[model samples]
Target chain A: MSQPRNREQTEQRILAAVGEVLAREGFTGIGVNAIAKQAGVDKVLIYRYFGGLPALLAVWGRSGQFWPRVEDLIAEQPDVLTLPPPERLTRFFSHFIDALRRRPLTLEVLAAELVARNELTAVLEEERERWGQAVATLLGGDDAALWQDHIGATTVLIAGVQYLLLRARKIRRFGAYDLHSDASWDALKASIAAYAQATLVRPEPAGHARQDKP
Target chain B: MSQPRNREQTEQRILAAVGEVLAREGFTGIGVNAIAKQAGVDKVLIYRYFGGLPALLAVWGRSGQFWPRVEDLIAEQPDVLTLPPPERLTRFFSHFIDALRRRPLTLEVLAAELVARNELTAVLEEERERWGQAVATLLGGDDAALWQDHIGATTVLIAGVQYLLLRARKIRRFGAYDLHSDASWDALKASIAAYAQATLVRPEPAGHARQDKP
Candidate 1:
């Protein structure tokens, strides 16, 4: 029992070191030697326990703390599903942004994902897909159909939130919004709610559907 | 005269080589040694001619090739301003997406911008700001006011296009749309047009303006 407990503690330390290195130096600093140094352990232990960097990162990604879980999205509003679709979207984005803003490590990984396609990012993408699927499950049935119908618009709004939040990690402002300020985020959230209300409640008229000229 | 002409040719070769290296290996491969090797020139020439990597990237960024110019946005639509606001937006996004899609190097830089904030991305950001200012000037007066009124929504739509386009460089699908497929892009563009039409034409009612809970 003592031996197994010791091994688990060492593994936990190694994982914690990955977050520290990632926060301080971004993905470029992630390596067995660096993590082992940060964890205050022998480099061979990392290989023996986690196999290698790829496997280590896979384990790290699987750790629920890497990205926001579905619980985070609905933490404040326990009866989130009881709200109207527009209100649900508003709360969802508000919670989503708040959750992401709190996690600097996740922001760093998201920024890195835009440029690099290494094992770390690959693992993170899988985790993001899982998170997305879980959210879909939570919004199952009628609400899911509504969002799916306007999938393109829904994707754009969510991606916009992601891009701006990721941009906030590096720069202060994007367009009119100061990413660091709560006021700007408030306005952004309102706009998203308004967009959701407009899109979900009323479908675009057929005659107004404009097609690009070939 | 011959000396100056030879120097000019060498400089062009060096700049071209930056693009080559950037496309092949992303921003991480950008350095004096690699660029010099690719250009088949002495490393000293990179410093003497362009004043080193940062200056070289700066000049390269300003070379009218790093990103799409305002001209690219309105190339096919000289009478774009005469159209309605929604039509102008539709045309702008269509042209903008097409221009970006045509320039693989620009997409590479955009992706790199999200992760790393090196000299290359810094120069590119300045160029992007200049291009944005130029677009703003073109859309000055009434149209500008209209866009400003719904700036948050407008930013989200544009950022969505950018994020999705950048994602397409690495992954094939994002949500319901296949990033590589034209049909998917058509759907995205249509959604943007619909969104622009909706937000611009109607202001949210006062009673419906939902403020997030404190």
Candidate 2:
């Protein structure tokens, strides 16, 4: 592989190795040494690729590596906001969900993000607010309530999924990854769309939904 | 105050102080030294009352220290499960939301927790999971799917509220404390109840609901 390709390959190998370790050994279970050892690379190389273990672990948690593929999947679906007036909200929500199903890591990140009670929640809050603002603009409501409903629905769906995963007695018992499945992914998308449609169509406080933005 | 009463009073005072710090300073902002100085209690008392800074902070977060009286207001509400069977879900959801509104800390804690990104989230996930499971049990369908939906919805609502709290100019924004209004609270309660009713009364397939314990 060329040097650029070589770098990509190395980073990919490391992340994959880290995932495997995370699978085998929970978040607290894996360490720099173990991840490096698993990838058959030196610890220094791991540092070179990722600032350190916590940083690497956080990246994995954020699902950054998974977004490109998710974005592609989202692009494959019709944009929910692009439809003619009436259909815009319906189509936008439907396709937004379709995109969510294409990436399991998105769900994983969301599950962790919701229950975050301490210091780490800042990033989660910031990410959702950013998305909420975008969604609010699309929904054509005063940014406040629109973002609230949009972000709230998304957070609960994630928690609900995580709850199910635990009820299945996988992660709660073993701290293991749920073997990803198409049925679950589809369900997540459908539920999200259903919730969003319910949200957008619902009557808002008078004058609130009539924003100048969208 | 009697010794026990005095200690309890002291503990409450300290917890309140910590809450004030967290509200203003964020998690990393407060220190044992600062809390001691701000609280006007001997520094050693913090360690004595709550083992360490982290433990004390957890108490502050969990007890609704900053916003005070939300849980009390919620506790004052009639238990939702006691209502007519069909109305129980609505009542329960409404009551829970009333509690959330009364305690805006529900949103603040959630936002702060996402950023804290430490053992804090682990603690929150477990705590919220238990609360969700309890809500599921109260609803008609306490099965895995219902559990998923109830928990998921709750998580998302909290997230949405947090989204509103975050100053999102690119999207939408809501004044932090001011967003809580009786009418808005009523709407929130209704929305939550409606969503939960839809979920608990007619849960979809496991895969579709994306039910999993996080």
Highest TM-score scorer: 1
Worst 10 residues of 2 chain B by lDDT: B168-177
Among these predictions, the greatest lDDT belongs to 1
Model 2 TM-score is 0.47
- In the range B1-214, model 1's lDDT, one tens digit per residue, is 1234488899999999988999898887889999988888888999998888889987887775657778778878787777766677778888888888898888888777777776766766666667766766665425565566566776777788888888887766676678999999998888887766655542433456322111
Tens-place lDDT digits, model 2, residues B67-176:
32323433554464354443554565455545554544445555444334444445565666565444445453434454454343344444343343332211232322
On a 0 to 100 scale, what is the lDDT of residue B106 in model 2?
47
Model 2 stretches with alpha carbons more than 4 Å out: A1-74, A78-187, A193-214, B1-13, B24-28, B42-51, B58-79, B82-86, B118-125, B141-214
Candidate 1 CAPRI category? acceptable
- Quote the true-contact fraction of every model: 0.50, 0.05
Error of 1 at B47 (Å): 3.1
> In model 1, where do residues sit more than 4 Å from their true spots?
A1-7, A137-145, A202-214, B1-5, B137-145, B202-214
